[model samples]
Target: MRTILITGPGGSGRTTVAAATALRAAGEGTPTLVVGADRTDTLGAALGAATGPEPTRITPNLTAWRPDAAARFREDLTAFQTRAANVLDLLGASRLDAEELTPLPGAEELSLLRAVRDAALSERHELLVVDLPPTPRALDLLALPEELRRYLRRLLPPERQAARALRPVLGRLAGVPMPADWLYETAARWDVELAAVEAVLGDRRTAVRLVAEPGPAGADAVRTARLGLALRGLPTETLIANRVLPEAVPLHGLLAQQRKALAEWTDALPVSPVAHLGHDPRGADDLAALAVPGVNTGHPPVEWPVVDRTAEDGVLVWHVPLPGAIRDDLDLVRRGDEVVITVGGFRRIVALPSALRRCTVAGAALRDGELRLRFAPDPQLWPR
Candidate 1:
């Protein structure tokens, strides 16, 4: 399934663009599902129909959903409490009621990821359109699956589970009760779900369609979004310049500013300009008028290749492709076998490969949209 993730700066009409894109695909006879991630029903408002937990059929080929994120969070929490009932009973603690529980921060992102995975794996939809949160939040959401998986592995190493029967004996010696089996079981389940979500996001058929009203602020937001997406190895399919003033109209003021911004963006990236609807777009008619493009076959994931320069430079170069990263804003530090790289204001900790683990960072530089880090073999760790 092809997934189109739409996001932009706040108030950029990204939800409208996502709706238009999904509607267009369905009109063309393709089965499509549009999922929205918003605390409010912004997507439903754009569609001019109420959406909820159950899928709402807009057109014969189109379906829309705004999953009940709060409900999902509450269900997970309830299950956790049930699994640890013995522990709570022993400690004389009260269990949280499902009715009183609310989703904490980050629940929406996890919910959105699960919805995407479910829709894609269902094999019922040919295309999936996602109305993602604003640019900053969407980037963080996309990174969550991988980051959470890493944390899960560190906190509950799978190999340690091999000694499950020995846990009681070890606990007795330590004079403290070991964690219950359910804890490890829960962690394992979460890891599997997160991995599935990551696979869907990293699929070649998945791509980001950035929607922004062409202007100075929009330009900066797009630059930041592109840098963040690149760091996470996600490909951007198209930049949708939202609410573009019609070319037929005489250019002046805001219209003139849009032209300049569009020209700059067009010179650099593939851009799709969505004309202004004269008012906030609503219903099928308004969406059809926008005429957004169909889903794009996204670009291949970026590769971090290790180039050998042992003979001449006595170091290996790790080339990381960062299309819009600023040189001066790049910084990195090698910690153990992982490198924490900060580009602009975004940071990601990437674990090194087995070969690179034995090498020490010699130098790093940004050249032609790529960050190159040269690593020399560590005398202590490298085979002598």
Candidate 2:
């Protein structure tokens, strides 16, 4: 399915933009699903209806949903308790009832992954519109799947599952009860689901649409969002300049500020201006008035291609593009087979390419928003 991930700074009308875009696609006879995980029910307001944990029909071709994170948390915990009942009983641990359970802080954000994976994989919708949290939070949420999967690998180590029969013997030898088989099974299931969600995010057909009111603060937010996403290799296709003033509105105050921001944005990326309707957006009429663009052919997924420079520079260069990155805020550390890239408040651990893995980090620099790392052949590891 083709998907559009919409996000912006708080109060930037990203939810409205997402609703309008999905409505536009549905109006044109495409099957569309718009989902959100925001606690405020913003997507429902934009859709002129209430949404819930279940997908609700907004129109013949459009469906809307706001995943119930608390409910999901309760269900998951209850199921886990059931699976590990013997383990709990053996340890004399008390099982908490579902009624008294409350979701943890990040439950809401992580719930979005399950929602997206289910909707995208079902083949029931042709276009999916995701109303993500404000850009900063959304970027972190986007990174959650990969990060969680990494943790899962470290904790559960799927390879250890092969010795399942030996678990009992090992536990006997250690004179302590080993974790139940259900634990590894649950981790494996979660890993599969998280992988699916990560695939949806990294798919070539998925495009990120950045929404922001054109102003100084919005400009800064947009730049930060762009840099953060680029650092993670998620491509941003367009900037939806939301709540724009009319061109004829004297062009002297807010309009002038907006115009200036738009000019800057236009130079750096494609801009789609959504005129303000002079009120908070609500219902179908308001959404239509926004005139948000429908989904477009998305760009190819970002790649970290290695450039050969062994002849001239005696090293190979690995290029990682991170637009809008500042030199002062960037840091890199090579950790075994992987490199940890820290830019500002964001960080990503990237595995090295096979050829680069055998070489040592000769030098590294951030130039023109691209991070270039030079690798010199290591006599010990590289083929002689």
Candidate 3:
């Protein structure tokens, strides 16, 4: 299945675009699912139909879903508390009532990811259109699975789980209590779910579709989003310039600004301009008229591999595609066999390939939206 993640700066009409895209696919006789997260029926309003937590048929072949984050959060937390009941009882703590359980800051993101994972794995839809949050939040939300999985492994290594049978024996010898079996079981379950999400995200059939109004602010947002997405190696399917005014529009000022923005994006990514509909689309007919193109077949997953330059310059270069990375916000450090990279507010520790593990970071530079890190093999560790 192909999944198109749609997002942009807030109020960029991403929801409308997502709705139109899914409708278009459905018209072409493809099974399509449009997923969004809103406290209310924003997606339903766009589709001119009622949508809820469950899949609702919007048209002949398209289904719409607006997952209820608050409800899901409540259910998840309740189950987790039940699983750790013994631990809570030992601490003399009472369980949280469903009414008192408010959704946390990151709950919506997790819920959204879970919805996407479930939809993708179900194989019911040939196309999955997700209307995501604005650029900054969306990028962070998309990166959650990998980052969380990393933390889970570091905190509860799977190898440690193998010593489960010996945990009680070791605990008695050390005069301390080991983590209960439930803890490891919970960790293992979480790991499996997170891995599934990550697998869907890393699939070649998935691509991000950016929807932003044509203007200076939108341009800046796209640039920042591009940088962040590039660092994670997320492939962009299209840069949809939404709400573009017509050339004959009397306002010369806005027209010039939009044209400039369009030109800049055209030079950077795949540009698809969706004209201003003059009013919010009312239903499937209106959405179809908008003609938001059906999803592309999609490209292969983005992978950053170190290119060997030993014969040419005796150095190995790691080419990391960071489309909008600014030099000022970029930082890199080689820590043992992993490189810690901080681009803007996002940071990731990526393990170096075996060949680069014995090398020293000689230099780095950002050019043409790619970060090139030069490495020199350590003499002591280099193969003679």
lDDT of each: 0.90, 0.90, 0.89
Error of 1 at 6 (Å): 0.8
Task: Give per-model TM-scores.
Answer: 0.94, 0.96, 0.97
Tens digit per residue, CA lDDT, model 2, 76-134: 99998999898889889999999999999889887888999988897888999999998
lDDT of 1 at 170: 98
Error of 3 at 1 (Å): 0.6
Q: For candidate 1, which ten residues in a row score worst on lDDT?
A: 293-302
Which tens-of-lDDT digit does each residue in 9-120 have in candidate 1?
9999999999999999999899999999987888999998988898999889999999889999999999999999999999999999999999899888888899999998
Clashes of each: 0, 0, 0
lDDT of 3: 0.89
For model 2, which pairs clash?
A: none
| Model 3 bad stretches (over 4 Å) | none
In order, what is each prediction's RMSD in angstroms?
A: 1.9, 1.6, 1.4
TM-score, cand. 2: 0.96
**Runs with alpha carbons beyond 4 Å of true place in candidate 2:** 172-175
